[model samples]
Target: MTSTVYAPHDHHTCITAALANAKTLCESRGARLTPVRRRVLELVWQNHKPTGAYELLPQLAQDGFNSAPPTVYRALDFLLELGLIHRISSLNAFIGCAHPGQEHTTGFFICRLCGNALELSPERMQDVNTRLAEELGIVIEEQTIELSGLCPSCQLAATTAKEDIA
Candidate 1:
């Protein structure tokens, strides 16, 4: 199966926007958006991809944040509670949510060719879960729907490279 791969954007803008939204939500909820939490969130959103907590630590250390694993874990837990991020169980990594501060079950479209992970919104999740429930009488409690195939850009590049070789 194939899906359109996305291009890189202003990652700085994305990280900033996500952090801003998170802060707004925390403030509205009377929750403390602590510095460690904010930095962790920023790091997660910075990549626009799933990141393991261990990998995230070095970035924090480099930034002069001498936080232990537990600190990062707490931050991740807070983000998960607020629906600002979701853990990709299969990969043991976390990805930033497209829409934060909303209730939604996470679904990912993970590309095998390039390892790009994309979030599926509520409408798409409903369509898929509805079919599963209707056909198999199975309610998806937690789903990690990672479609493994060549993403669009990778496919195009492969084809072009093949043509050139020929």
Candidate 2:
């Protein structure tokens, strides 16, 4: 079964692991993870929800960072280049990558009700991409699939509300 971000889990542990993995990957790649870049990454992993640059500006400002548009943009660009984060084009927001130090296409299942985003596993992603390539006869270059709908919890709530009213 695919893991859902909305499902209860130890998010603190997930965040810690992701950060550590990023640090290790950066060090091995000889990338300088500056203080601002590190903090921006931390904020991106603050929750399961994808965050927009504007949403992060105030937080950075409160933390005494420059919080300017260029600063945030540069950090975001660096993270994207390093594959540390994924941008949800549909929502204009960014989310921390669940898996780092690997090259794999990511598929996002975004919850419309709660705005939570979950990354599909690499295995599942590969299967889907393979199918698409075979069916379309096109070589895939870049992939970022974004699907939006109600999550399981939201579906249950909607059903319960309907039953109650009926």
Best by lDDT: 2
TM-score, every prediction? 0.88, 0.93
Kindly report which residue stretches of model 1 are placed more than 4 angstroms away from their true locations once superposed: 1-5
Which ranges in model 2 have alpha carbons more than 4 Å from their true place?
1-4
Per-residue CA lDDT of model 2 for 1-166, tens digit only, reads 1364788787887778778877898999999988889989999988888999988899999999999999999999999989899899988999998877678888989888888889888888999889999999989998769888998889999999999999
Best by TM-score: 2
lDDT, residue 126, model 2: 94
lDDT of 1 by residue, 1-166 (tens): 0122257466677777788889899989989888888888988876645789998888888888876899789999999898888888888989888778988755787766677777876678888888989999886776667555676777898999999999
Q: RMSD for each model, in Å, please?
A: 3.0, 1.8
Q: Give all candidates' CA lDDT scores.
A: 0.79, 0.87
